[model samples]
Target chain A: MDHHLILRVVTRLLVAPILLFGLYVQFHGDFGPGGGFQAGVIFAVALILYGIVFGLSRLRSIFPDRWVMRLLAFGLLLYAGVGVVSLIQGGNYLDYNVLLPSAKAGQHYGIIVIELGVGITVFGVMMAIYYGFAGRPPSIEDTDW
Target chain B: MTDLAVTLLLFFALVSTAIAIALLRSLFAVVMLSGVFSLLAALLFIAMDAVDVAFTEAAVGAGISSVLMLGTIALTARHEMKPKRWSATPLIIVGIIGAFLIYGTLDMPAFGDPNAPVQTYLNPDFIARTPKEIDVPNIVTAVLASYRGFDTMGEVAVVFVAGLGVTMLIGGSGGFLRRRYRETVLSRKDGQA
Candidate 1:
């Protein structure tokens, strides 16, 4: 009980900073020590921390199944949006210079946008996996409880 | 002095960890050791100047995968299951394969050699062509999203398939059986502690 108490306390305290760092990493990937994948992991880790201490019930409220599915779709949509934006601007699919008025800035913008997509999808996938495993079918043996 | 000592201590800690993993019987210990090994491997990668691979390993291996495994562990602990011994044959087979892999690494370039075949071949082309062809300053992104797009697609498919499989197998709500593991663990705690 004490161990769980410690875990709960630590998780709540640390989750905020982990999330902030993830955002920072996502935005600052092109210039710094982190990127989409790293940010995704950090973001996922924070949630995992919450799951570890509090159980799956807490996570359900924060990230319902429907919303998580949508987040996954949203990530892919972001990536596809970039591609569509490029197509409309007269370049090949996924070509990013079409993202902005200026070609060079568009490239950077495109990378960041794509990275955000990757991060969201990854975060969603991680949560979905947690949900799939942590949530399971009932059996006769479980009736004792 | 302090920096050198810290690296050396970390290396020593890693060696002891490896030994502990080799000797331990508990599955939780094994999982924890694997996380430690992955972390050590990440540090080794960083030391070798493989920042990209290091980042990937640290993120996936240490952060996400560890969390996933811990969740799995917690769920299983709720149920009372007999401790079955793991088969040694599989372990032996894996050991032989791992030995061969280590041997293959020997034939590769020496650690951090500037003239390593990998660095010489890939980095030069990446440095040159990224600016000219892709027009993306961050060459790794260009290489990941476009140049090696097929690989990324494969990874996405792998994730999709896994989630699909899990959803298929588990199906519907996780009510009692899911909580069983936690209950058993709590009972065990009450009994033992």
Candidate 2:
């Protein structure tokens, strides 16, 4: 195969592994060093490499800049909103115990929800960042490429 | 003996990788090699038994940062031609500092003895009682989202500020730029259709 084909093939092969690794880290973050932020970045890298090989425009056709932006905003809102809600629930700021009515369950639920939010936001932001750089001037088309 | 051997190997791997990163000329190569540095640092962290930190450093510093740098390169520049006048003085100074850091290692506690300064003074009371009091499995989590929660709050606020700043800097000017882009993208779609 030609060099371009070789590059394409290698990149394709790498994408799945990177994404799987990202997910592994994300869910396993509780006991280990992996967490939402780190996993999100890992997830973003796979998309970025995909964007690179398939051309920015082609990548945009699938993910789109607008949805990515909305997702980014949504993640941040989810995180902040959770913090405020926890505060209002009678726990201190970001106090997970107050997140739910119960104590331990609240803590567990709070961490899960918040981290998941962070992961979503981080993932979206990472992609938005990539989209900003990769598909700076995004189209309004929501079609599948 | 095995542990010492592992630590020493990690040290050498880290040093050699750092040196290679410094010596590399190409930007892409530099990014990739710096990733090697992150990976080596991760291994060193593991050797020291800081499993959580090792995982983070390996995943983010080595993985995400490398990819981000690569993307920035793609968006910006790729191959870097050698500078016309590369100086050796800065390199010498950096080398000396790095050597000093290595030299300073002589004073550091031996690896993972549990009686080491860090382990001993780790506020064993808190480490011991936190799980019972907080009911969280991850001690780090208890410390992060609860015990040191105010700090986390401050951090979240800072993050909010940064997000705010980015929005402003990127032209959140009453959403005019967004509207304009929407129109352009729509018009393009209509034209293409």
Candidate 3:
């Protein structure tokens, strides 16, 4: 993989743009088609591409397994925390209307907050799954295919 | 109409792809064809005006699942094993299930019917009130993140648990617990012996 000049070069060129598109999808989801789920998967795709071309060890160095586990838990916590905050604010659970001075503003803020949580959790989980699959000891070699 | 023609063509392609998948013996080719099937389904979704669902099917189904399958093949055999004998049991079961499903669909409302239960339910209110309530242009987003926030939260938690399960099963740390448990059991047996 390291000797494949074209693949390495193309991957290097594509990684940054893929990550940028994932962010665009994540933030623009409110106004458009994409949301946290799509964006999270897209973001994970970029990292997985790097792992496929550059090797899993390199991907692990960049994003350690420990952090992946933490982020996985963190995303769900953020989502539940938002609900708790709303509950404490004298509104029904997950009622974004009470989060701010205005109902619309509160809805806007709450949606963004929860969407971020979804994105983070999805991204972490996807990468973790990829690591689980690719990190195993191979019974068959690359040339076997 | 062009939409109808394209939709029909895509459905035809989907059926063929599914049959091909069933007939193919090579696991690698099956995985590739499944990716193609997902892409076709995504096109169908787009034609039906469901761009968000289309994006997800294309990304997760075509992109990630294909890669994951390839990784799985690398870990195992490339070709599927031949069955020992031909059997009608599976075919009969499938036919019975398919008949029941088709029978069930006979009572369902037609696509985009104004009086359909879905349209008559909360959809009208969501569409009518989302502008002032959520202030978002996308009603889907308003409904998913605002009106049904608890459901989305639950989905997120499900994803979290899935990740945890994968970590416990296949991630490197889980092996430590297995080794420790094995050691404890062996020591107890040794004491008994």
Candidate 4:
């Protein structure tokens, strides 16, 4: 991996744009053909690509496992919390119509918040799975590839 | 005509890739071929005007899964182990199931038929009311996030549980419980000292 100068350089160049694209997909989902699940996977892909190219240790330093686990739970909580808030607002559970003064605005806010929750949870899960698989010592070497 | 041609070409590519994956002994090549197969399926989804589905297939099916498979190969063997003996039992079972599935599809309405049950049912309602109610440009998002919020919540829960399960299983020493146990032991040792 150290000898692959071109791969290292290209990976460095590509990581930022990949992350930006993932954000675009996450936010633009309402108007376009992407959403939380796709966006989350795309976001994880940027980090996974960096892990594969640079090294797992380098990737972990930037995104520790503890943070990954926390984010995983937090995302689910955020989604469920939205429902609870709506319930407290006198709407039924997950009833977004009462989330705000305007029904349309409530729906918009609820959808965005819930989508963000979905995205965060997905991103965490993907990264966790990657860490689970990649954390194990490889039986095969770099030369095998 | 061009759409039909592109679809047929993609279908052919998908089938060939599947065959290659089955025949190849090298696990690496098989994994790569499966990714290619997923990409072809994504292209087919696009041709069918299911862009959201296409995006998911391209990202999760082709991208993440391939990398995971490669990680698995890194942990395990590069080449598949040859079967101890050729057995027709599994093949026969698969063939029967495939025939039953094809037979089942024969009774279904033609693809994209306006009169089909799915097309005539709640789909039209969702399409009709999405702009007025949810007011999102993407009907799919509105339906998934708002109209079917509970189902999406369940899906997210499923994803969360899946991550938890995997983290508990193959996560090795990375498990939170394991780390806590280690910390407790270290504290006990310090107290003893």
Candidate 5:
């Protein structure tokens, strides 16, 4: 992988834009086709591409498994927390209408926050799965491909 | 119409890719074909005006899954081993299941039918109320995040649990727990010294 100069250069050029696009998809989801799931995969794809090109160790060093696990739980908690907040506000669980003074604003805020939660969890899971698979010692060599 | 033509082309490509995946003994080639199959399916989703689904299918199905499969191949075998026996029972079972699936679809409404049960149900109401209620340009997002927020929460939980499961199973011994264990062992050694 280190010897593949072309791949390294191309990946370096592409990673940032890929990450930025993932963010665009994440935040712009309300007005567009993409949301948390798609954006999360895209975000993971950028890091995974970097890992494939550079090395898994480098990827881990940058991200770290501890943060990955924490984010995974935090995302789900955030989603559930929003629901609890609404419930405490005398609304039904996950009822966005009661979150704020205005129903529309509540819905907007609720949707954005929940979508962010979804994005973070998805990103965590994807990276975790990648780590689970790639962390293992390769039984096959590069020439095996 | 060009839409119909494009859909047909995508379907053709998808079937060919599936067949190629089935016939290929090389696992690598099969993985690549599966990615192609996903890409074609995403294109078909786009043709059907399901851009959100298409985006998800392209990103998860084609992109991440392909890379993960490649990682799997690196850990496992590159080539699928030839089956020692050609069993007709499994083939018969698959054919029967496939037939039943096709039969089930035959009772369903045609593609994009306005009168379909799905279209006639809450869909119309959701569409009518989205602008007034959520006011999001993307109705899908509104429906998913606001209208059916509970279901989406469940889905996020599912993703979290899946990550937890994978981490427990094969996430390798290199995270916080391992570091803590090492620290404890080092402290025990220091006490002995």
Candidate 6:
């Protein structure tokens, strides 16, 4: 895989921009055609592209399995935690009105935070799934392709 | 109209790609064709003005899933083995299911009909109130995260659980973790010597 100099160079150039786009989608979701799900998958695609071009071992070193597992839980907890905070604030579960002084402000803040949670979980899950599949020994060599 | 023409063309392409994927024995080709199918569907969604759905279909469906399928092929067989006997029963079952699905759609309203039950009911309320209530430009995000927060939380939970399942199956003990642990141990022992 390393012998393909062109592939490696192109991947290096593209990965940062791809990740930046994912963040843009994640944050700009309220105003645009993206949210946690799309942004998360896009972010995962960056890592997956890097993994494919370089190798799984290099990918794992950077995105350790332990962090992936923890973040997977962290995102879900963050989502639920938001709901609980709303409940504790004397609003219904997940009611964002109480999260801030103004109802609109709360809605804006709540949506952004929850979407971030969604983004994280999605990114983690996707990368985990890719790792799961690619970590298995390949039956055929690269030359076979 | 141009929109109709574009949609019909994309739909025809989608159908052809689906059939091609069904007919192809090569798993790799099937995966690639599925990605093409996702792209076509994404284009169709854009034509219908559902930009959010289009974005998701393009990114996850065409992008990540295709790559994942290729990774799967790397692990497993590239070509699907032909069944010893081509059975008519499975074909008959599929035909019956397809017939029922088509029949189900027959009762549904035409695409984008303003009077459609879906467009008439709760949607109007959301649209009218979203600006003042949520103050967000994208009603989809507002409804998904705040108005219908529980459902979205459930969806996130489902993804979390799915990741857990896959990690259990492929990340623990007999998987990458144990193997990496052994390598580290061996390296540490050699370093100490």
| Model 3 Cα lDDT, one tens digit per residue, A1-145 | 7777999999999999999999999999889998899999999999999998898889889988777877888888888998899999999999999999899999999999899999999999998888888888883354665
Q: Model 2 over residues A1-145: C-alpha lDDT tens digits?
A: 1246877898889999998988886776656566666777778778777776767766677776666656666766676677799878876667777766677777666666666666666677666555544344432222211
Question: What shift in Å separates residue B46 of candidate 2 from its native position after superposition?
Answer: 1.5
Evaluated on the second chain alone, the candidates' TM-scores are: 0.66, 0.75, 0.88, 0.90, 0.89, 0.86
What overall lDDT goes with each candidate model?
Answer: 0.71, 0.69, 0.90, 0.92, 0.90, 0.90
Better of 2 and 4 by TM-score: 4
**After aligning candidate 2 to the native by TM-score, how far in Å is the CA of B174 from where it should be?**
15
lDDT by residue for model 4 over B127-181, one digit each (tens)?
9998898899999999999999999999999999999998888883557777887
How much is B109 displaced in model 4, in angstroms?
A: 1.0
**Which lDDT tens digits does candidate 3 get at residues B1-193?**
9988999999999999999999999998999999999999999999989998999999999988998898899878899999999999999999999999999999999877899999999999999999978999889889999999999998998989988788678774334555686689978999999
Backbone clashes in model 1, listed as residue pairs: B78-B180, B78-B181, B78-B182, B79-B181
Q: By DockQ, highest first, what's the ranking? A: 5, 4, 3, 6, 1, 2
Full ranking by TM-score: 4, 5, 3, 6, 1, 2
Tens-digit lDDT string for candidate 1 (A1-145): 2255776787789999989988987777666556666787778878867765676677777767666666766776777787788899998787776678877677777777877877887777777777776665321132222
- The fraction of correct interface contacts reproduced by each prediction comes to 0.27, 0.26, 0.78, 0.75, 0.90, 0.82
Return the lDDT, model 1, position A140: 13
The better candidate by DockQ, 4 or 5, is 5
State in Å the error of residue B83, model 6: 3.0
Reference-based lDDT, residue B116, model 4: 96
| Candidate 3 ranges beyond 4 A from true positions | B173-193
> DockQ score of candidate 1?
0.30
Give the clashing residue pairs of candidate 5, or none. none
Residue by residue across B96-166, what tens digits does model 1's lDDT show? 99999999998998866889988798888877877765576567776776555445545654554555456
DockQ of each: 0.30, 0.28, 0.68, 0.74, 0.77, 0.65
Q: By TM-score, how accurate is candidate 2?
A: 0.76
Put down candidate 5 lDDT per residue, B55-136, tens digits, no spaces: 9999999999999899999988889999998889987998999999999999999998999999999999999999999999
lDDT of 4: 0.92
**TM-score for each candidate, following the candidate numbering:** 0.77, 0.76, 0.92, 0.94, 0.93, 0.91
Say which docking band candidate 1 falls in. acceptable
What is the lDDT for A15 in model 2? 91
